[model samples]
Target: MSSSPQTGSEPVTAPSTTSLTLAIIVSCELMLMLDGTITNVALPMIGDGLGFTPAGLSWVTNAFLLAFGGLLLLGGRAGDILGRRRVFLVGIGLFTAASLLAGLAQTPWQLVVARAAQGAGAALAGPSTLALLTTSFTGEHRTKALGVYSSVTASAMTLGLILGGVITTLASWRWVLLINVPIGVLVLLLAPRHVAESPRHGGRFDLAGALTSAIGVVAVVYALVRTADHGWADPTTLVTLVAGAALLAGFVLVERRAAQPIMPLRLLAERTRAVGFAIMLLVPMVTMSFQFLVIQFLQLVLDLSPLQAGLAFLPMAAGLLVTSRTANGLLGRFGTKPTAAAGLLLLTAAAAWSATISTATTYLGGILGPMLLIGLALGLVIVPINVAIMSTVDPQDAGAASGVLQTTMMTGAALGIAVLSAIYAATVGSTSAVLVGDDAVALGMRHGFVASTVIAALALAVTLAGYAVRERQSSHTK
Candidate 1:
């Protein structure tokens, strides 16, 4: 196992060809990332249109999340054994068709099923984009390409809220899903010509590993989702949590024995890669919780319309795009550890600042600064961590690596929202005394931000500790 990350078995493509390929890959990623948050703004519209009970409405989001998060490992490995380009096309095509089905769905169940199909498609296609990008470029070109990818990734969720608000306001909520159709169609048609296929590894599919891991992930994510509605002590939550843990333990056993494991356990063996993955998990925990709580603050306390609330996130998106363009240079100059630490520091400050907001706090006075800081932090943080994790990955395990990285992120998001929402619920309590005004909601939201602050601080501590360990090892070698 060589540590050097070579531009895999892909042939050297022309610059024009590379640019087109990147465009296609980025387009696919944007669509997937957008879908993750786009429907959030339209949730009310969807619930009303489809006659969903308050409890049932959550499934629209959770269905897609469960499917995507659960199948990501299998999807990534499928690309390794099958073919990245073929898998990419098939995944995007399925996602596009599922989007259409969701848009046209007349019933709640129909839409939920379609959303799940979309997640399955995303799981298949998402890993290949990064795997392909890493394989297609090397040296400075790779860094710049990754910068672009990171920017798109970091900004897409915020952009999704903005676009969701726009589409839902002017047209209808259905357009939120339907919007992916043309983009997917374009990517599917152009991908084969531009996106070069990776050389597939020779191995039998790890069916047992796949089943255990996928089921385990789904069970865990379902448990997390349920925690938002039912407390952690609920019977369903406790049962699923234990079951998911057992299945995942079984998955580890299966992978260790399998000739061709879907998730190569060896990826987690390297300390740097492991640390990078941990940071990746923790960073999303803060971001997702921040977004979830802040959106509620914007609407419930501030009386902003959906469109206005979405527009408020523009500064964060702008900061992300600007900082991402420069993060490559920062990585080149300061190296990975310092750059990541700085980002996490910024994240801590932003979360701490956001924790001080009240019902009287205006958006410009309180929200804008933290939003901008958070955006910049994410760009700086995500790029370095990505580079650190993927830069030395063996091309043979690229898909699995990509899959694991994404799974960690999705799991982090799900876990963060559940935990923070639980904190909010606990603070608010069942008493009607606290329900008298928006002040209680504001206080609960403040507590959520405080928790986010603690999560960010913990991530920073871990990053610094990892840096110190690496430095000590380097001195010993000398």
Candidate 2:
């Protein structure tokens, strides 16, 4: 295995310009993250305006996710080979053009296609955001930058919901997508001036590995999305799932043989980094599932309007922003292992607490406390885990590493939604006769939260166990 990269140990940019550089990177990251959930609150409005059928409406969101998740690895590697700043501008430009297309789209298919294009652009840009941050800042500055980045990563979805509601209510649903035009144009204009380009690593691009990985991820994500509509036993689902797995296996083989692999296996060879990747995968599973279930609970059971439900997440957003800002201090004082464990512990507890909700439960009674705790837990967990994975990577491979991290996150989100949605569906289907009305839905949501609790607990176990083993090995060597 190759040794960890030490490039991040020192700053790449001049100290005077680091803050401006950070703002640019963070703004881009926020834009990407916000898009992940911003359209959700506006989906009904979009469907109505576009005359979408029930099943077809979902494609508006799924198309974006499928493309984004599929191309992230390729995007990251492209940044490494071609130059990050250049690729980032290309991505932002494409995304801006696609956003305009989406806002102007007359048909459902056109909108879906435009959304997919936007996702492709995001895939190109997403990895470089973190790659640039890791390369540009060092020491306490890196930690602080990561803290701000993590805060955006964790809270952006909730903020997106809020923003979507406000935009859709105050203006039209088109504005939700159209709003990106100005932001993207501004970013495109300023990025070249403020963002320093990374040194391009000279290598033969791993074409074979890239094709297999991208196709494999898209196939898998499509299969998972299908599971919400078709059962796991459906022939199409099984075929796609198997095909995706085979393609991914082929990608591994190709990567291993390639002279300059798109994703170096060496990155995962280190125990800490591998564990960090696993935890990142698992934590997102819980968070995405939690969000999905809670949104349903607020809208279906509590009968809140979209705007009200979006505003209800204010406390969680506030908590995330506050705690994420402070997480760097916690990490400095307690170190990555303990801080991560504590965060996971809190996440597990919050998921469990959320699982106790019923039809009778009020927002203040069961949801508020857990939402706040979830915010705090995510801030603590995401920042340290990001530090663990990115801080140790070789600078040359930072783009690839960032891509893998994001791809893992996307896969986890898809897996979580698929798994929890299946469970909830099964619960509701079986209990439909026994329970009446909102009670059945509440029970299903509770079951989904229960599953999320288990997922969080497993992540906690892995984190603690991984650290314990490392400590034991250290003592033995001593």
Candidate 3:
């Protein structure tokens, strides 16, 4: 490597060691990302095996999402205070053990509990990878490492759909959870040998901030998820929403006073990072909603096998991988604002087109085209969005910023699914209607797609407006 100093303040390591570190981090991240959706394809089988009622079945996914999203800020702060490597190992071990329990679960409740444990572990481990990257590599090495990280994240999600299908098809839904055990074990073994311990800040853990924020988010997510079974105006839903909002407000107050807040308030005040966070929250909402609805449409409406439904996403993944470089080029040449705007516009169009799918719609002419567009849109926007989120933040707050971004992503996914499910339910008239006919289900899916289109259009508008403001500010400063 060249003699130029690395971006991080840490001392440089041997190239071979650096390579190993990257491998370990990327693999761990892939595992984490995969779990977010792998269970989706397996949900039907899992529900059948556990004899879950329709309402209870959603917890299989929602449990993990709520825990993971709610605790991310605390986890990132833990890495900053207690050391990233230690937290990472702890997280992997917890997650691995939880996976085993989930695989062996005898009841729906057991599986849901195990899934929540896995999410908690994931929250601890996920942010550490970014923290490790910030402190480990420098120069061209850092760029390459980050690029690989982003690509793996984008691809792993779709890969989960495929992997979930294969396992659930040939073997059992239990294998979907079981597969993670070995991967987690392998990562745990390899991590200590390759990854260096992060330097710990002597700051306090900010337990008050951690607890309040986590609980607040969990409550909000719980309320949202319940809306599928109970309408938004239900007494329990209203109470939970009010409680969640109050807790979150209290969290903000706690953070403002706490010496070592899990999330630094100052980070959110930055214009570019704030905008990035908003976009990150909204984009994932659309993508996750799309994935959830489309997969169901393929399997339920078209009556495709699990394997076929999983394999259907291959084109989308391929398109995303192919377009990633072009996205990076666009970011370099055209800038974050315009490139992101264009990408979101494409995504909006894709969402609109997807809304047109019906029970009679064929894979070739309807689904495949939208999937390709979704992939391309993902490639064109994600990296630049990351750039905007982190570019202006202080180096010392990297962990916190990363934590916030990740938290938003997970929360957005959970919220989107819940909201979309509600829309799906409304369009279908009732749960009874959903089970009555495929036509009702198809109509519900279409409604969900239209809602996602609205979300994408809003994101596109945000990108355009935020960048315009940024440009105006730059000119004024000049």
Candidate 4:
């Protein structure tokens, strides 16, 4: 096995100014996250314009995901080896060029290729964004910065949905991809002047580790996605699942032997950070599944248009915006453990309430309350969880740590959607049979929400257990 890097931790360089730097990094992150789901609202239009078969059209989204999810670890390690600023700018430049190509694409395949390129660019940039945030800001300022960053991350999905609906309806589906071009260009121009360069470590790339981990995660995600579409027993799904497991096993062995491991195992050893990662993974799982089910309920049961359905989520977005601004202060006063636990309790309560929804439920009654609660809960949860994760990480490994966190969030959301889709199918019965009526759709959504409640409850239980453990250890120290 290769040894850990012998380099001393880099001293935090006090930036002369943080406003411009924070804006540039946060904007880039917002763009990357927005792309993750913005295409969803415009899928029908895209399929129509590109002449895609129903099944084939999904690749337009999956291509980006596979590339982005698979390459994230490598991207983080690259930032550590190369300068963060250099890699960040290169990624932005590539993303902007790809966005232009995607907007101009006439063929389905061309758009798919462009989307994948954008994903690769995003993978390269995403970790650097978090790394920069952690490196640039320290103490109370860092906490506040992370709070705003978390808010942006939490809101980006909804914002993307809202933007996708408006843009697709008012203009064309192509503009969803086109919009990034200008934003990317602006960031690229500003990044050089504002963002500081991170110190480069001397090491060879962990090529084997990267290849195996990327392929493994991609295969796993592919299997989950297919299982959601097809049944769990599909031969293709089974084969891919097994292949993914084997590749991931190989990746572990490779990492143990590599001179400079891309993801150091030591990061997971700390109890607080470990809890942070677990919550990051599970919390998004709950939120993503909620979004998937609620959107279906709005569209299928309520017979709302894409635009209307998108607009329905605005209350939650507003609540999130308001609370995220003050999350750092809450975290400072209450601490992450208490703050996070309170948030999970609220989330659990909201999910439990959402489970009672039916065809008779009204937006103002059942839906709006849960949406607002979820927004407030998420605002409280995300910032502290982020603070907990990055609080103890060594500056030298910031890129890798950020990569791991991002990977957890993406993989969690994907898995949550897949599992929840399966639950919805099972609850409604017959995956192949389309839902016959509003009642059927409503019942299915209720079942999905019930399942989501289970997930939130589990997350809360884990949080409590982590607290108990911390208490016992503290007593021992005394």
Among these predictions, the greatest TM-score belongs to 3
> What are the root-mean-square deviations of the candidates from the true structure over C-alphas?
4.9, 5.4, 4.1, 4.9
279 Cα displacement, candidate 1 (Å):
1.0
> lDDT (CA) for every model shown?
0.79, 0.78, 0.79, 0.77
Judge candidate 3 against the unseen true structure and give its global Cα lDDT, from 0 to 1.
0.79
Q: Which 10-residue span in candidate 1 carries the lowest summed lDDT?
A: 469-478
Where in model 1 is the C-alpha error above 4 Å?
A: 1-16, 47-58, 106-108, 425-437, 469-478
lDDT of 4 by residue, 1-478 (tens): 1122333355424345468888888989999998877876676567667776433455666677667767787889998887677788888888889989998999989998999899899989999999988878887677667777888998887787778778877888889999998899888877776787776777778889889988887787668657645768899999999999999999888888888998887788888778878888888778877776676577667767767777888888887887677676776666677778888998999899999999999889899998888888888888777767776788888899998888778767766666666566555554232233667667867887887899899999889888553221112110
lDDT of 2 by residue, 150-257 (tens): 788888867987887788778877988999999999998788777877766666677888789878877876676566567789999999999999999999999888
Task: Give the distance in Å from residue 469's predicted Cα in candidate 3 to where it truly belongs.
Answer: 6.9
lDDT of 3 at 410: 89
- Which pairs clash inside model 2? none
Name the lDDT of candidate 4.
Answer: 0.77
Q: What digit string (tens of lDDT, one per residue) describes model 3 on residues 324-370?
A: 76665666667778777877988999999999988889899899999
